[model samples]
Target: MESVVLDEIDLSLIHALTIDGRAPFSRIAAVLGVSDQTVARRYRRLRRADVIRVVGRLDARRLGHVVWALRLRVAPGSANAVARALAKRPDTSYVQLASGGTEVLCGTEASSEHDHAQLLEQLTETRPVLAISAQCVLHVFRGGPAAWPALTTALDPGQAARLDPYPGVAPSEVVLDDGDRALLDALSVDGRAAHATIAHATGWHESTVRRRIDALRSAGALFVDVDIDERLLGVHANTLLLMSVAPAALSSVGEALAEHEQVAFAGATTGATNLVASLMCADVYALYDYLTDRLAAIPAISSIETVPIVRTIKRGSIFGG
Candidate 1:
């Protein structure tokens, strides 16, 4: 279960896995000063309990994918039909039924502005759709999976210790073939590599390369040809707001935060800072002070742990080391 509760050690284990799904249990145990068996047992329990899942987080935009969030209002009795139809497209990455209810979100990848329009058209053409609105996938928050309290202060030392943990992966995982591996390696170096150049380097026909790329996209293993320049795009500043909210204030606080355009991602986890958010801002000062003022304004707020990003480790194309 979803109902399974996580202690500090469990949270730490989660942090480790989130960073690198393939991290070995032994390595995790070493990092946590626990036995490998302890790490394995805890992780197995988490897996069986459906607490955490290990999945690849590839850069979709790097593969030339422009992510968008489509809100679909389907005709009565056609919700399932509409969802099924939308799910079939390779461009679609995430689908959700928003809290207000029947509006289904189809988060997907698009080749370009034209492709996004075509995707919206396709959604409308589907029999069940009554109306559809698509919001571009502006940003993805690489943060804790769920609501986590103030791991920096509120949670027990053992719990907070796992706030920034590590883990490893096993062999026989989703191993990449030569062609795909080479492509990824190249893109890792230069995400904007030209198609003809890539084909020349790989000695594959241009069409063959294209097909393989298509296959990767359909499989949800790769994202090609995405154009996202956050700095130039005016979403230059980023902040990780670590919050400590009283249980009574969580509803209002969470909803209010979620409604803000600045909030890129939100998660509820098992720590003192019950809610964490990734926010984009206009500038360094704004990012810094926005969270400061918001947290101070909340009466139920106990403390705030805001981590302004120093170096962007990896984004659509930018990478640190």
Candidate 2:
């Protein structure tokens, strides 16, 4: 797919959403100082362009499912079909063809690496694929640098760069030696840096410069991404399906629901409600119909609590703990 580039106003609308998706068009209009109709027109355009999607964030770990990053090597001419197939799976969300050929980045609800492998095995029985590399996420960090700033911001020195470029992974930019530290401190305030500048200023061996950066990433700490526009906190309405289960069925059932893309956070808590989930989505109507039909297909559920999130106070340990 081609990239959708937004103009300045479009970017502003995104930032406003990052702050609060439910933000009324009247309110957004006030902030952006545009008429409500203008806001509406632009929003429709953004959606049509596919540059922004409002989605719900499910706490999968809480829900009893594991999330994984998938890299797939596909047969020639099969990338689109494979992606379309994976996209249909409730267990699979977020398929991207990355810089690598036929690579796909997806989030799933698998509690462990073994669980994901089993899922792949089951999937292969139906749709055979070439190769798959998977990474289990340890955590997801959220809410850093405030949208536009986050998009443009580099990691501040000594501060762990907020927002893991890779989900559930830590930033790699934090480990700067004294010399690298000095140079990075300069670049933190400014991204553009000349080689002589980094070298002369930091007093490091110039030959080892790029190597240091490689060490940071190879160590699993550093990543950089283009800044994201602020989220007004986009809305993906979710159904909270609750269950009555025998003690033995509690863990596995909760785990299964959590892996569903529409199911967000899942857990077995004390109450008439044995399980809970926060489903993430963009199209509320589809999600609503999906829950009533598809999730209802799962007999374990007896009750469901559906809610739409209005705002996020904070996200992840990415915030100062």
Candidate 3:
């Protein structure tokens, strides 16, 4: 895809949504000092171009789901087919082809141990798969709705405060009932779906639909995210870093990496290499500088392996072309 140049207002609009994906256009316009129609028009253009998408996702941990970061080495000719198959699963997200298209890396959420084991068994039985490794996430330092700062240009604190729709409290654990699941399913498709549409789908009153969604957002059990092709936003490279960090510095290193603007996702995982991070860079040379300068500055890292993302098959709940 050709890159699109973004002006201050364009970037501000994206930043505003990153702060709150479901914020009213009028509210965003007020924050960015533009007409509501302009904000709405630009958003429509971006969405239509596949430059940006808004989606609501459930916190897997709160839902009692085991999240796995899986890597698969497949036969040369089967990478695309295998990746598309994995993308179709309801539990998977961030599926991508990496290592010059010989491997696949993705995140999958399983409802239970049995479900996780079953998925692995199915993959292992596939004829094209040569080997696979699964790493269970122990701690998430960044990712999802909360990690939307990669495209951030600038926004005043006051504008941010006004834009935050769910500001009553920090997220808390909440159990989901059947109605909640129905609501979430709708949101997974479109976070900005109207309450009326959601009500119809869930067989509940519009007011009931609104109330349940509010509760979920307030509890931090669910949050909305905007998915934009980083290339369109001037980010030309993305890499996954597998790093071995000293046991005692795990938390500090993870937290520190989480603070970097290039880091789209960072986490501690159960594996030989304990730290995993996803970074977006301007290009390969920028990535090289980041690894040699920024990453090398970290005292705790003992070793590192970098895998450049060749293509993203899916992100959030939406599949890519």
Instruction: Estimate candidate 2's RMSD in Å.
Output: 20.4
TM-score of each: 0.48, 0.41, 0.95
TM-score between model 1 and native: 0.48
**Model 1 Cα shift for residue 136 (angstroms):** 2.1
* lDDT of every model, 2 decimals: 0.53, 0.48, 0.82
User: Lowest lDDT 10-mer window, candidate 1?
Assistant: 312-321
lDDT of 1 at 125: 85
Give the per-residue lDDT digits (tens) of candidate 2, residues 1-321: 235566666766665654444356777777676899998898777666544454323234333455554546776666666767776664554444433344443445564668777877865664436776554443332222222232222222222222222235443324334565565444432223444566777777666655664454344432221222123224345233335667676666666664554443454554545554445555668776777786777775656655343322112211100
189-303: candidate 3 lDDT, tens digit per residue: 7888999999999999998998888888888778787788888757878888999999999999999998888888888888889999988899999999999998989989999
Better of 1 and 2 by TM-score: 1
The residue-level lDDT of candidate 3 at 232 comes to 70
Quick one: ranking by TM-score, best first?
A: 3, 1, 2
The segments of candidate 2 whose C-alpha lies over 4 angstroms from its true place after superposition are 1-5, 62-64, 98-103, 111-118, 141-321
